[model samples]
Target: MARDRLHEMRGRVAIVGAAESDEVGRLPGKSALMLHAEAAHNALADAGLGAKDVDAVLSTGRQTANDVPEYLGIRPRYLDNTQMGGCSFIAHLQHALCIVEAGVAEVVLITHGESGASRVGMGGGDRFAPDTPPGQFEMPFGIGGPPTRYALAQARHMHEYGTTREQVAEVAVSTRKWAQRNPRALMRDPITVDDVLSSRAIAWPIHLLDCCVVTDGGGALVVTSADRAKDLRRKPVWVLGTGEATCHSIISQMPRFHVWDAAVMAGERAWAMSGAKPSDVDLAMLYDAFTIVPILALEALGFCKPGEGGAFVANGRTAPGGALPMNTNGGGLSYTHTGMYGMFLLVEAVRQLRGECGERQVAGAKTAVCHGTGGILSASATAILSTER
Candidate 1:
């Protein structure tokens, strides 16, 4: 895979450093941009570089009005603000690579943070585009927000394939089981499928536990060309391939009962570009915006058949000590969510490939696959990373 990948692409780019700020359910004291700057500085320090070494800045627009770097008091030779919601992290990786390969930047700093739970008084008053089809077609119908929109997808998945509440709960339960081993994970309470099933339902077919936690946290990663990575402290994990795909924004626009085509499309493209197969992945860091998202992504990524995602993870396939370990850092299900789960996905994959994870480490994890979803399953980005030099 490494040989074919390098032969196919430009000079290799490596994820040399990664970092995260303190995570909490809510933090009103520190703003979102502060977290981003902290994570960015730590990431640079991890890479054995100073802010002065950074030549590029790639940031996601925070839920707040100000941009991330504006608060950090730092700028770079390159700047990219690609905002597709959560997938921004993975998409930024692609854009950063282009900047580096084009000699526009030498060191690309990608950062993200969110105080989504702290925005209590300041309402999210109409963040969507006025002409956005989702707002016009769905918002006026008392459709609530992303939680309810995903609930409709869950119901449709259940209707098309005889998936049960326990199957969905299985995802939540399995994630919590893993979270117990992850010290940084937020919700570490021992949980069961019954507990998840019995948790208060946020929307029909979606329990409170099924929905992701609102979190205040930040994540950052430093990307540099392979020539420069050898000078860094840790072993470099090459971003072998990256791909993105998207469906219509609204839940109504997607085909009823058809799970995310974007994930599969991007997954296939990444695999083909990197010359990696499912069997080659030692670990998986799939985005877990909701329990259902990873369940659906597993099937789309060819971990199982279309209708077998629930049964695929049944009897502890995705749980701790399972065949293929997923979200070893607890994931969005249990770990810091910070609005964009995509950064977590990339960070976890790098952690695994670098052999940084302590107890949850997948032994001999030379290669890994990470998939991230943005919006209400509207878009997806897939990446295959390898430890091979």
Candidate 2:
């Protein structure tokens, strides 16, 4: 008989803890470093382990890897600062698995915090200064921040797929339905397609409600060997599969606007590693920097065929009590988004797999697929997690 190839890192490591900072909404008083420390402390406590037990650290945003260790008062044997925009933590999980599986680190902590709303201690001045590259070219042509830049791609999708404004607005409305159940959600009042359509337009096709909220928050995760995780205080969310890929840095340079090819490649690798199909996923924590993001990701991830994403999510299929409950914490759209929304994706996935979500919880969510999109659809990372080994 022919020998079978091995999935070396599958189910080798598990997330022992996942938590957000003390507060997720606007907190002008808290600095970026403070959020990191608070989230780290909370995650460690969740794992029933202290900072002293951590041998590796991963972080993003203004906080560097070395900065986090010193601030948290831990001396990590290994460290990573893989800041590929928001999806950095997903990539961190992949690296942490390798580190733990190789016996290099017993415990790994990945942290993320950003003062996105208050802009406290953040980089000074406008991100797209007229003197900068994008400013010199894109700005002069009326191209602005992410909403405007990403709108170009969303507009393209509408043209090619015959996707209507109502189809795109459905994403925002359905996601809000989930948000209404979450007490921590920022904009959980509830919204409708008409409300979304009438709302002020940030860009042509992108409305204010269609975009993710800007908030001040942080999140952290604790990863260790699956064996060690089994003995922890909480159920371990196994890292069944992980994949990452990068496309273009700037939105203008992207090869395609309608579909994110990187997500297709990354999601394929993750599903292949887990040996599971899209139907196997109980929940999906897709990055919603904008409504179009998850729509395209759904197609790229094989949840639906390309150009069919509009129909896939039209009637609240991804909303609460639907076929697939997604972003039960309300997601970046209704939940808190501190610039890099990637880490929160993993946090919610872990919580769901642990059976901790109260009202918005999927009835029996055992598996989740968390995906992140960084930059202007430049980078992507996909992770498949499950409760069972």
Highest TM-score model number: 2
lDDT of 2 at 297: 93
lDDT of 2 at 192: 87
Clash list (residue pairs), candidate 2: none
- Kindly provide the TM-score of model 1 when superposed on the true structure, using C-alpha atoms: 0.93
Candidate 1 lDDT over 1-389, as tens digits, reads 43333225532788998987756567787676777877888788888888878888888754432355566666666778777778878988877777777778878899977776675323354555557786688878877767788887778888888888899888888888888888877799988888988889788788889988777877899999888898889788898877788876667787544588888878887777777788888888888878888888888899888878888888888777788888888888887787787888888888888888887888888888888988888888888888883
Candidate 1 whole-model C-alpha lDDT, 0 to 1: 0.80
Candidate 2 regions with alpha-carbon error over 4 angstroms:
1-6, 125-135
Top candidate on lDDT is: 2
Clashes of 1: 0
Alpha-carbon shift of residue 356 in model 2 (angstroms): 0.9
Per-model TM-score, in order, reads: 0.93, 0.96
Rate residue 376 of model 1 by lDDT.
80
